[model samples]
Target: MHSVVIIGAGGVGSVVAHKCCQLPELFDDIVLASRTESKCKRIAEQLDKPVRTAQVDADSASQLVSLLQREQPELVINAALPYHDLNIMDACLKAGVHYLDTANYEPRETACFEYHWQWDYHQRFVDAGLTALLGSGFDPGATNVFTAYIAKHYFDEIQQLDIIDVNGGNHGYPFATNFNPEINIREVSAKCRHWENGEFVTTPPLSMRAHYTCPEDVGTYPIYRMYHEELESLSKHFPSLQRAQFWMSFSDAYLQHLEVLSNVGMTGIEPIDYQGQSIVPIQFLAQLLPDPAALGPHTQGKTCIGCLVRGVKDGKKRLIHIYNICDHQACFREVQSQAISYATGVPAMIGAKLVLEGQWRQPGVWNVEQHDPDPFMADMNRYGLPWKVTELDPEFQLDTEEHQATNAVH
Candidate 1:
């Protein structure tokens, strides 16, 4: 029987545990761990199936190595902070276990996030005979898979790729993040970029916007183009992509509040002297905001995330939009988490399962799309994240006829 250990007991972590429990045969042994033992214990208490809980600071590789040594899990799912990704990867390498995580790593001191830090470990993991799957969560995870799916089945050569992520969920709060407030705010505050003509063009945060009508009656949302980490990896992996961009929805109210906060320097990541002690403003703001996990009961609406591709199939121009819509209430009913966590957690569980089952096992650092998308796509349908693919007519504004025709020539 293969054992699995999940790090972090936050909203996403809780959903990962719940989803793992639903398939007890796949995950014979499960352990939930984080810096706070009580949080893991609290989540484990809600599960009907027994799961062990542990306390380990993800910031310390030694601590994680010690815990992994004792638990002897075959795989480790890291739902913890992005800053701790390297530490956990190190521990996994030391313990000879496969590693998977939802997001790319960013330095704790900087607001920047990228795949370089983790990708640098490719040779190390390859030599150690361990597989490290990066960005297995929804956007970087499923969105990546969606692109590969289209390229394999529909597109002959993808010319333009756009990843639209719209979270229409409302937590009934004036201004609160759907995930970790610190990470959410930092990501929004950074400079956005998109690849075009083999070069990156930069834009101010939330500067470019487009209106998108989501499928499944999810309604219209204003999505802003941003430089998500997936774009970085996808652009490298999919060379046919001439222009690649990522868009996310944000309410006017949310943007207005963010502007005011930035004006007052509340969004600053640098430390400031407060009461004779150094403290980061963003960290202070996080402490003041409501926890994302607590918003599960109050949040309502759906999240629609997918990939829009303009390419060629069978020597003809083709445009396909593949996406999944997840309801916050449905996720809360099933796992006591909002759709954001559900969307990310479900894929994390699926990726860990893929590793444990030997379906995607290999000794190298990789991304989800690097492996076969067939099993992962099937798992999405069997799990909570059902997807849909639709052929677009010429009227689709996501791409131009010239771009489509160019890929058709490939």
Candidate 2:
């Protein structure tokens, strides 16, 4: 049994803590911390078993270092804002604790989303004999694992990859993000880029579109192509990948609201003087929007996320779709969170457990696909996020003209 420290107290954090409690033998002691101790305390209160709670400013490396030293945890699971990744990583190095996070580090001041920043720590972690796992969340986490599992067992060479993320959940709100509004808006507004022919090709954000009928009664939803951080790692790890892209579904109402917000500068991350105080427009907007955690009671529907791969196997062209469908109501009933948080948080717990149990420990910064996917996949089944794979003989392809027409201005 190993002690673990979890940072952040959002919907995802809550799920991670509950899932960790499920495996009491593996996680002997658990400490949950965030800047707001009350938030952490609230989550801890809901757990069936006892979990220690503390307040630590994740932005301050020294504070985190002190917490880590006091707790002496075997591993630290970071579920905080993406901006605090480096600070937490630095603190981990100081405390000599293994680190894992669900998302890549993205600075608050920049809209750029890439892995170069965190990947730079490879040498430091390797030299320190510490492990740092990046992108353990659903898409980057589960999607990466799915690709690796396919490459290992089924494919000779993966040539093309498309990751589709469809969240069909409804929170009964006209316009509200499922996660942090600031991060969500920034990611959607940024230009889309994908790897092709050994380099990244860029396009307008929400430019390329396609329609997909999600399996398991998910119905048809229009998905728009967007550049995601996972594409960077997958292309590097899977050298045979000639082209890779990421797509997500957005409703017409949501897009219209986003366009209006963009026009009015409400989505702007830049600081503005409002009533004698400087405030980031996006951050202020986030304050007004319903918190993702609070949406649990009202959120209903399902989420379908998966990887569609086309490659060569046994000298023959092949295609496969490996995906998972999660119910929002089911997740709420279990952890007081929607499926989005449950999906992301469950993998995070499993990833950290794998490390603490010594099943996935390694001395270097790594992505989910860098390790064996079998164990992680098995854990997912035991946990909440079970997955399924279906072979596609004809391959999942969208008509170019139809796809373009969908995205065309009405």
Candidate 3:
């Protein structure tokens, strides 16, 4: 029986545990761990099946290694903070266990997120004969697979790509983040970047915007262009593309709150002296916000995330948009979580299953798209998060005059 240990007991972790437990034939034994044992215990209690729970500091490689050694899990699904990605990877290497994570690593001191730090471990993981799968969450995860699926079946050579993520869900909270507030704020406030003309062009944060109408009545939303970690790997892996960009939908209320927070220095990551102690403003702000896990019951609506690719197929120009729509309420009914966590957690489980099942197992670090998209796409439909693909008009365009004007500057 193969054993798997899941780190982090937050929203995504809870869903990962629930989904893995449902597939006892694959998971065999399930262990859920986090910084707080109580959180893990609470989630385990909600599950119909039993799951072992533990508390370990993900920041400390020694602590994680100790737990992994004791648990003896064949795989470690890291649903923890992005800041602890490398530490958990180190522990996985030491324990000789396969590793999978939902997000790429981001340093705590800086909001910057890139694959360089983790990719540097390619040789080490390969030498250890362990597989490290990165960015198994929704956008980076499913979107990556979506792109690859299109490239394999639809496009002869994908030239332009646009990844659009829209969360039509409403948690009813005035200013709470769907995930970790610190991570959410930092990502949104960072400068936007997009690939163009063989180089990455930077723009002011959320400076570029466009209106997109989602298929299947998911509603239209204003999406702001932003830099996502998957673009780094996708562009590098598939060099045929001329441009790639990521856009996310955000409400005016959320933007207004973020602006106020940024203007007042509440979203700063750097430490500031406060009452004879150093404290990061964003960290403090995170504590004051409602936990993302608690918002599941209140959140309603759906999230649509997909990839829009344009290229040539059989010597003819083609455009395709492939996406998945997840309902927050439906997810809560099954896993007691909202769509944000559901979207991310489902893919994390699928990635780990692929690794353990030997379908995606390889002795090196890899992103989701690096593997065959056939099985993963099949599993997504068999599991939750079913997707659809549609051919777009050849002249379909997402780039607006504003985006063009901004791109012209560089």
Candidate 4:
């Protein structure tokens, strides 16, 4: 039996706790923590079994260290925001606990979504003999695993890659992000970078658009090219990759609202004086938006996320797509969270499971792709996120075009 402390009691955190409880044989003890202890308690109530809840300021490394020392779990599953990733990792290092997170580290001041900040901890983790698994969520998580799995099973060497994410869900809201609004807005508004011909090419955010038709009648939507953290690690690990890009679906109303907010400076990260107190506009705006956790009750639709890889297999050119489809309502019925949280949360549990089982417990900071794909892929099927692979023509391409509307290349 393994004990785990899952920080941040959001939708994803709730999903993780419930899923962990489902398999009591592996995760016998579980603790959920957040800045708001009430939130942790609320998620704990949803689980069928008992789960400990605690309050900790995720922003403070010392507070996390104290919590980790007290709980002394075998692993720390960070369902917290990207901003808290480094702090949690630091706390893990101090407490001699393993670490895993769904997202890469990003400073609160800037939306710099790079892996170097977390990857720099590789040596320290190795020296401490503690494992730190990065990007265990869907895009960076399952998507990274998908790329590696396809490369291992179907390709001799991968050259070109296009990770297409299409979410056909409707929440009946004008402008609400599936995850944290601040992180979502910051990511889309930042400069876009895509790996091409051995180097990253920078372009304006959402400057490149394409039309994608998802398989199995999941519907057709417009996908926008954006910079995702997985591209950084995949390129480094797979040097043969000549071109790699990430694309996500965005809806018209969401884009319109985001543009209006950006035009009015409502999405600004810098704090501005508001009636004698300084407040970050984006953070304040996040308050007015619908909580993503609540969206589960009203959200209904399907999500399709896949990676299309073009490469050489046995000296012959090949193209294949490995993807997973998730239903929002199905997820809500099981975990009381939307598909966005479900898709991300399931992978996190699997990653942590692998770590506890010693399959991926190597002492070092590593991305999901750095581990064996077979175990992770098998668990996806055993758990909820079953995947399918479709062999495409060697000439399949992501045609660039103008598009509008949809969300979740998460």
Tens-place lDDT per residue, model 4, 340-407, is 99999999999999999999999999999999999999999999999999998887677787444222
- lDDT of all predictions, in order shown? 0.89, 0.90, 0.91, 0.92
The sequence of per-residue lDDT tens digits that candidate 2 reaches over residues 1-410 is 88999999998899999999999998889999999999999998899889999999988888999999999998999999999999999999989999999988888887877889899999999999999999998988999999999989889989999999999988899999888888888888887888999999987788788888999889899898888999999999999999999999999898888888787888887789989999998898899999998999999899999999999988999998999999999999999999989999999998998898787899999999999999999998889888998998645586332232222111
Better of 1 and 3 by lDDT: 3
User: What C-alpha RMSD separates each model from the true structure?
Assistant: 5.2, 2.3, 2.6, 2.3
Top-down lDDT ranking: 4, 3, 2, 1
* C-alpha RMSD (angstroms) for model 2: 2.3
lDDT of 3 at 324: 94
Q: Give lDDT tens digits, candidate 3, residues 250-290.
A: 99899888877777888888899999999998999999999
Off by over 4 Å in 4: 402-410
Q: Which stretches of candidate 2 lie over 4 Å from their true place?
A: 400-410
Clashing pairs in 1: 156-312
Report the lDDT of model 4 for residue 100. Answer: 95
CA lDDT of 227 in candidate 4? 91
Question: What overall lDDT, based on C-alpha atoms, would model 3 receive against the true structure?
Answer: 0.91
Instruction: For candidate 3, list the clashing residue pairs, or say none.
Output: none
> Model 4: clashing residue pairs?
249-406, 250-405, 250-406, 251-405, 251-406, 252-405
Q: Give candidate 3's error at residue 210 in angstroms.
A: 0.4
